[model samples]
Target: MRTAVVSPKGDSKFLLQMRRGGLVKVYDSCLMAGSLYKSLLVSERTTAEEVVQLVLHCYNSSDRGSKYSLYEVCPIKSYERALHSNELPLRIQQNWPSPEHFCLPPQTESGGHT
Candidate 1:
């Protein structure tokens, strides 16, 4: 395994992550809290798609990656939105007025991100 380098500004430098039948949280992206989140380093350049890949890498599985979606979640105001593949994680994070979190939750049965 390789070590992830953190920038002076504390941006995650990028490593990896994933989930099969579970969920993963990149904090400060929403209001939900759980034990699944740790510290994964991703920079301002990291995209929603790239984060999915990192999640898969960190999960050590190439299985059914499409079932997961990166979402900007805010439980307090009941706001949740799926992020575009090309959208920048940090860029979105930097624009939040209140506390929000990023989560790679499994898609709902209707093929929507939950």
Candidate 2:
């Protein structure tokens, strides 16, 4: 049987971007207690950088039985690119339809909805 596993670190980069954009915050009362996972779970203010740091800390501190690594969980290079560039990613642009393609058909004298 194939069991689905849910990960808390899935969107860590996106969250960091959101925090950098001023759309979220990285620290909170809960985070001061030193529970990284709990801080991430409860606060929408955590940044991507903070998440990356937490993941790294967890991965480095874990024993041999750990299932994943920081490199496997986070896209470090992509995040770095995003931090340096202002332009949207090519994938996002491709998904967005061109405005020219949405032009309305030339209207006739009869403007009835056929």
Candidate 3:
């Protein structure tokens, strides 16, 4: 797959949204049954930390980006793993046999989904 770089220094256009199940929601976005997954267009070099920033950007959240955590979730395999701060999501995502998504929860590091 062709890779593209993403950065906070870049504009909002570089920021992508991933809506999987109930983990994320775009404010004022209309509900649609087939809109479960929206592709995230970050490069393989993009770190989990950067992805967190993107998620925060999506929510217009005022909280520190450090307060959130990103996880690679695969409902088909019935598995979810917390990604390291420096990990690359695109790399993990490429390994997915089927559609998967990153989970950004405030307390995932502490075993809390909320």
Candidate 4:
């Protein structure tokens, strides 16, 4: 049996890769599905006191026993800033066409064909 090399320090980087590599829809779905519970702990909607209970419930219901739910890892303001600052490792704009010369074809031909 062989194992692939993956650095623990690159967990977030791997996740970003997964997102860009066509896994974004499902990953975002999980995030959105669990967002309501996360939103409840957002700065003003609820107090810090309720965070733990809400997180525990969210963990049980959706996190599949993993402690990766955002609440436990995100109560601190600095962590939030760090999370927001996570830059995309890959640059994509270089592959797209510029809009300056953009054009569209006619909707129909003289023969009334699409």
Best by lDDT: 1
- In candidate 3, position 80 carries an lDDT of 69
Give all candidates' CA lDDT scores: 0.56, 0.27, 0.54, 0.25
The better-scoring model by lDDT among 2 and 4 is 2
By lDDT, the better pick of 3 and 4 is: 3
Candidate 4: clashing pairs of residues: none
TM-score of each: 0.58, 0.21, 0.56, 0.18
- At residue 105, candidate 4 shows an lDDT of 12
- Evaluated at residue 94, the lDDT of candidate 3 is 61
For model 3, the superposed segments whose C-alpha errors exceed 4 Å read: 1-38, 100-110
lDDT, candidate 3, residue 16? 49
For model 2, residues 9-69, the per-residue Cα lDDT tens digits are: 6664322222222121122212134532322231234433344345335446442212211
Query: Cα miss at 114, model 1 (Å)?
Result: 7.7
Which tens-of-lDDT digit does each residue in 1-114 have in candidate 1? 335555565665765433222222553222123444534566667777777677666656555545566777777667778888888766776667853343445343255542
lDDT of 3 by residue, 1-114 (tens): 334546765464364444231123111111123334333467667777877777657556676767767766655667767778898776766666654243333333345543
Overall local distance difference test of candidate 1: 0.56
Candidate 3 clash pair list = none
TM-score for model 4? 0.18
Q: Which 10-residue span in candidate 1 carries the lowest summed lDDT?
A: 22-31
**Worst window of 10 by summed lDDT in candidate 2:** 65-74
Q: Give the higher-TM-score candidate: 3 or 4.
A: 3
Per TM-score, the best of the predicted structures is 1
